[model samples]
Structure formats: structure tokens, C-alpha cells
Target: MEMNILIERLQALMAKGGRQILGIAGPPGSAKSTIARGLAESMGRAAVVVPMDGFHLANDELVRLGRRDRKGAPDTFDIAGYRALLDRLREGGPEVVYAPRFDRETETAVAGAIPVGPDVRLVITEGNYLLLDTPGWADIRSRLDEAWFLDLGAEARQARLVARRVRHGDTADAAAEWVRTVDEPNARLIAPSADRADVVIRLDA
Candidate 1:
């Protein structure tokens, strides 16, 4: 979708008053973060981007759970904590709401990273499982005022995933292998959730 059009749509949604939570869900490498950040930038202080990756389990915890190899899978996150935060964000309050952020370089979640104020009219939270309908994930959809699913061709998505892995220190071959073994399965799981989104956005490279 054109960025200008999306901005206008979100602006219209914000015009209704009260706090609005906008969710952008997609498979890895679908530019969820990029789009969410762009929207927040366009809206300025009126909006804040709170990413779901911040709910990722610590690497040590993942290893203990034997889920290190599939870190981005559904069960690898703190779903309860994510849900609680969403509840609080939806409720709105007088004080600043601090949200965690995931650092790709460290592959760790830094607590109290992003601050969302009560005055903020829009909260853009993007991630892989926003529209997922499993036990823990099902609660997220209702919290969003509007849910958007980003759709990208598998070839382009996989290429971007591989490039991202390489940029994060994996060798080219290792990156490709990881994308095939880990990301592809997750992508398959995420694709169906697009049906739950209010709108599906076809994205270009």
C-alpha cells in the first residue's frame, strides 16, 4: 500500500478520539518494524511504536526450554506479559507506559525502553503473532483497534530474511540454512493469520 494513503487512514482512525492501537502483523522480513517506525515518525509524538519482539524469552531461558533453535516460534515469547502490557496500553493511564525493546545485535530484550504517554493517540505494535489465534495469542487481536497484515512474496521475504541474518553476523550459507529451517516454518504459521487482519497490505521490496 502507498505510505501516504496508510498515513491518512491511520490519521482518520485517530480522529475518532481516545487511544487507538494499530497492529501490523507479518512473517519475518516483511518490514513490520520499518513500516511501524515510519508510521510513528510521520505521526510524531502522537504515536509510539511498541514492538512485540520485546516479549521474546531470554536466550538462556530459550536454551533451558530447549527452544533456542526455534527462538522466533510462537511459544518462545512471554505471551502473558505481552498480553498484560497490551491491556495496560489499551486502558490508558496518566503516567508514562514503558515498553521493552528487542536489540537485534544483542538478541535480547531491554526492559523499559520505549515510553508511551497517555496523550499519545496511536500505538503501533508490530510483530509476527499479533493476529495468531492460538491460546495465548488469541487475546491480542481484540486489543487492536485495527489490524494490518503485511504480505510479501515468499522469494523476496526469504531473501530479505537471509540478508538480515547475514547482517547480524551469520555466514551467508548459515543465514540461508537458518532461514530455511527456522524462519520458513514460522512464516507458514504466520501466513494464515492474515485472514484475521482488518486489512492485508501487499508490500514491495
Candidate 2:
């Protein structure tokens, strides 16, 4: 989608809305967070971001479950908590709703970090599993007013994932290995969920 067209569509949605929730779903390296954050930034105080990353299971919990190696997988997240929070956002009651935020350096989620005010019409959420057809994720589609999927090519997506891992302090070799062994499988699962989105955005175009 062209930048102007995307912004205009969002503006129109805001104009017609009582409460509007936008979900951006895609593979790990597809830049879902980037686009969602950009939209909220452009909309200023009228929009707020409530990222799915904030639902990540703490590292110790993952260790106890023996799933630490597969940290980014769908099952590793607190899907139930995420869904309940989305429900609250959809129902709209609190004068200020507190949501969690993920800390990359610590690789954990901080509770009550994002304060979403009642006046905000748009709640922008981006995550890998928003459009997934799995049992736990199915109801997410019903809660969203609109959902967008970022479609990026395989080569570019892997490259971006590798770069992100390195920037987050992973060694080059470790990043490549994790992308190959872990991220790729998750990406394959996520790619098919694009069909469930209201819009499939081709970022490379």
C-alpha cells in the first residue's frame, strides 16, 4: 500500500469509529511492529500501541517448561492473558487501561507499562499470531476492527531477522543458527495466516 493511501484509510477508520482496534500480523521479520508504531505515531495522541510482545512468557518460566530454546514460538506466549486484555480493550471501560511492554534487553515483559487512555479511538496491536487460525488465537480476529499482514520476501525477511538478533547482542553465527533452526519454522506457520487479514501489505513494493 502507498504511504498516503494507508494513512488516509486509517484516518477514515478513526473518523467513523467509536472504538477501533487495528491488528498488524505477519512473520517474525516482516516489520509488523514498525508499521503499527508508525501509524500510531502519525495519529499522535488519538492512537496507542498495545504490542503482543508484552505477552511473552518470562525466561524463567520458559526454562521451567523446557521451552526456552523456542522462545518466539506461539505457544511460548501468554495467549490467554493477551486475549483477555484485547477483550478489555474491545469492551472499553477504564479511564486508563494499563498494558504490558516487552523489554528486549532483559527478554521479559513489564506489567502496567503502557497506559492507553479512554479517549484514544485506535488501538494498534502487532504480533505474529493475531491472524493464526489456531484455537487459542481464533477469537482475536473477532475483536479487531481491521487486521493487516506485512508480506515480505523470504530472503529479505531472514536478513532482517539476522540483523535484529545481532543488534540485540547475539553473535553473528548464533543469530544465523537461530534464524535457521527456530525463526524459519515459525515464519512458515505465520505466512499462511496472511490470508485471514483484511489487508495484505507488500512492504517490498
Candidate 3:
């Protein structure tokens, strides 16, 4: 879908009044963040982007759980914390609600990074597991007023994943290996959840 169409749809959803949380979900490399930011930017003060990435477990915690290598897996995130934030956002309390943000350069979640004012009516949250039907994730779909899944061709998605890794400092060979060994499995896990989305935005087309 075009960006303007997406903005219009989101505007209609917000038109219903009360706080609305819009979820954008997809596999790794689908550029959900880009879409979410675009929508939020277009809406200006009316919308804020709160990514699920901020719930990523700290590196030390991941090591303790022996999930360091599988850092992007669903279990590697603070599911309960993310759910709580969404619940609060939907509930619309606190004069100003703060949300964490993931810093790619530092590879850590920075607390209180994004603030949602009381006047803001729309929250655009993008993530890999918002529509997952599995335990610890199923509730996420219900928390959002609308959820969108971003779709891209396999080859295009894989290429973007590889390029992202390289840009983040990984060598080309290592990036490809990580994509094959880590991201591909996660992508498989995320793919089926697409059916649960209210809308599927095809990025490859």
C-alpha cells in the first residue's frame, strides 16, 4: 500500500476517538520500523512510534538464558513488559507515558526514550511478533486496534537482512551466515502469524 493510503487508514482508525494503538508486524528485514516511523511522522504530534525492540533482553540476561546467539528470537524479549506498556497505552493514563527504544549502534535498549503525551491519540508499534498466535504473544494482537503485516519476497527480504547486518559492522560472509542460521529460522516462525494481520502491506511489489 502507498504511504498516503496507510496514513488515511490509520487516521480513520484514530477517528473513532480514545487512544489507538496500531501494530505493524512482520519478519526480520521487512522494514516494519520504517513504515511505523513514516506513519508516525506523517501524523506529527498525534502519533508516536513505540517499537517492541525496546523490550529486547539485555545482553547479559540473554547470556544467562543461553540465548545470546538467538538474540532476536521471541523469547529473548521482555514479553510481559512489552504487554504492560501496550496495556497502559491503551488505557491512556499518566500525564506522559514513557517507552524504551532500542539503540542499534549500542545494541541496547534505552529506557524512557519515547514519550507519549496525554494529547496523543495514536501509537504506532511495529515488531516481529505482534500477531503471533503462540503463548506469550497471542495477547499482543488483541491489544492493538489494528495490526498490519509487512510482506516482501523471500529473496528481497534476505538481501535486506544481509545488507542490514553488513551496515551494522558484520563482515559479508558473517552476515550471510547469521541470516541463514539465525534470521531465517526466526522469519519462518514469524511468517505464519501474517494471516492474523488485518492488513498485509506488500513491500516487494
Question: TM-score winner among the candidates?
Answer: 1
Task: Please report, in order, the local distance difference test score of every candidate based on alpha carbons.
Answer: 0.93, 0.89, 0.90
173 in model 1: Cα distance from truth in Å?
0.4
How well is each residue in 1-205 modelled by candidate 2, as lDDT tens digits? 4667789888877887698999999988888887888888998898999999999999899999999989989889999999999988888876788999999888889999999888878999989999999988887888888898989898999999999989999999999999999989999999889989988988772
Candidate 3, residues 1-205, lDDT tens digits: the string is 5887887888789889888889999988888998888888888899899999999999999999999988989899999999999988877866688999999878899999999998888899999999999899998999988999999887888898899889999999999999999888988999999999999988753
What overall lDDT, based on C-alpha atoms, would model 1 receive against the true structure? 0.93
User: Model 2 segments beyond 4 Å from truth?
Assistant: none
Work out how many backbone clashes candidate 1 has: 0
Candidates 1 and 2 compared: the better one by TM-score is 1
Least lDDT summed over 10 consecutive residues: which range in candidate 1? 1-10
The candidate scoring highest on lDDT is 1
Number of clashing pairs per prediction, in order: 0, 0, 0
Per-model TM values vs. the true structure: 0.97, 0.95, 0.96
